[model samples]
Target: MAEALNAPTETANAHAESFLRDACATLDRLRAMRPAFQRPSAGKRIRTAFDLADECLGISVEKEALLLRQALADRQNLAAATSAALLRLAGLEMGYRRTRGYPAVAQSGDWLQNEQFVARNSDLKKWAESALYMSAAPANWTGRIAQALFGLAAGAAMAFAVAAAILANRWFPAESIPWAILIVISYILKDRIKEWLRGGFLRILPKMISDRMRDLIDPKTGRWVGRTREWVEFPAPSAVPAWASPLAAGEFNALRREIPPDDVARYQKDIRIQAARLRRAHSRMNSITEILRLSLDAWRERMDDPCERLRFVEEGRVCEEIANRVYPIGLALRFSEKRQGGRHLIRRGTLFVTRDRIARIVIEPTPEGGIAGGGAAR
Candidate 1:
């Protein structure tokens, strides 16, 4: 009995340590390749190397989560051990970031169109561990099927209108003047019909069909397991949820006096999995994680300089300091699983952004919910 209980702890520790070692090794390899990536023609090579590294890092993180759960269930006192491992992992990320010189490399002409793949290594790994399921295709392909289906429906509506007009002309032989008038009316109505259908579909599709569908594949079995939908909207201050508005308000109140109400946005992604299908597809698989990354490049286009001059007096002497100016974007995430008595988890955080990139993120502890920002990273 003692040995059986000890087995889980031992196995979990082993897996966790293995992930740490693998991550360290991967970073070391990337450090060695940094010099090669500095060349002008190294664009393709850079993408290939980073893409592989990202995928491996994502997989390692997911496996670690699985092990972490097992260890916790076994009631092992491994908090310190796990924290140490995670701290080391973060250290590796910082070292890699400095070694790569992301700010310099990102400015190169060859890095165009590929900038999104870099600089978020740490954030990606953090989210990957919590992702509910891995996307079979790249993130860009998530909502493609739904888009094509809607477009097809609109096109079919136009085709049917054209067919009906021809049938009416043939069935009733009218005068030239009447026929011309009929054709003009048909043309106007055809466009209106298509646009009306498209507008209505756009409004209703969010409820009926997900933004993403049928693309999530099980990594182990290479079979379909689940699907997901995502939404992004810029809501008015009055429309913000009561629970979340206070969090956003507190963030702005500390930074600036007057808040710009128009800039606030909300992002939500929903994942639905057929647990029975997942169990049948892979017996060992019980959890899935969705890793979502948002790019702030567009937001940085019109940003002011990264630093500003601030003057003050200290000890009866005037002094001036150039402080790095950072903008705070309030963020709140809510997670709830579809089950009886399932608890809703809301984690609040603020993203501090500089003119060039994200400086840091500070997540507050949720006193109400038992968990922290333990949900899959977005």
Candidate 2:
């Protein structure tokens, strides 16, 4: 009877300890990325850190889900966290794409697959417009034009040679034999001239020049280009998808795996005030994500510059890649939501707040218009 009573206490202690460890790990991860948060304003700084967190979480959640989805019936907690974190976070942001706009919204997958994350992934349009490729253009086009001119120049020069041979009239019955032989020789000379001009002279010459000239160029990824900052507001919470709701357990747990052990350990010493801390963290996360939305949008704008040069003037392929990279990631971060799960699942994993994945935060305000989130409800 005593053992049974103690078992409950032991289990609670273990879970509590685990929770504390998890919290500490998350904070440490955030701190480790402190440089990512350094910006002009506190609000901007908050948003930058929050974006970093969101991206890291995106890797964790999808990878975890993929492993579990594949594992099917045989699933466990530690296995879930470890496997998911490895799969999602492993080389995740590194695989991120770049483009000009945010995706529609993605409820699943890592950062690379989403179309909206812009700078997170590399888009073909951006690549084509990049300064490196544009730098090669002037030389390439010049070589082609020279190659054509070579044909004309060789024809004219050879015609002169034929006339010289005809006038010399050195060979046979000065009538036509020498002229005919000269025709053969002149044709041969023309072939040699064509070969020399097309292969080694202007045609090949400009490639070297192009390589040198290519240095002073910047590639634009879109139809336009420039730099500026402005905030475009998101639709109110209702319009966003359920999966995007920050408080939904699935959405919450979605990034649980990325929360590290060291950060979790720090939280253990202060577990007593967990409720308050969680509230603060939640608000912090909300503020950060909001900033991320704007930042990503800003990044999208950066990619919109067009490459008017000969290299990337064809814009189709690059545009598609950008769309793929940015669209879904933006959607997942701002508006998508996940499905509901059982009670235990609620405590163990993240929940989406909306169908399209947007989360809602209820903000409380001081008389001064300052915001606080003291209440436990999200």
Q: What TM-score, computed on C-alpha atoms, does each candidate reach?
A: 0.53, 0.26
RMSD (Å) of each candidate, 1 decimal = 13.4, 27.7
Clashing residue pairs in all predictions, respectively, total 8, 79
Candidate 2's TM-score: 0.26
The per-model lDDT (C-alpha) reads 0.64, 0.39
Tens digit per residue, CA lDDT, model 1, 215-265? 577665676666666666677777877657554456546665465554778
lDDT (10s digit) by residue, model 2, range 83-102: 44444543343344112122
Instruction: Indicate the residue-level lDDT of 265 in model 1.
Output: 80
Error of 1 at 181 (Å): 2.7
Show where candidate 2 strays beyond 4 Å.
1-28, 31-53, 65-69, 72-378
Distance from true location, Cα of 44 in model 1, Å:
29
lDDT for 101 (candidate 2)? 25
**Best candidate, TM-score-wise?**
1
Of candidate 1, the 10-residue stretch with the lowest lDDT total is: 99-108
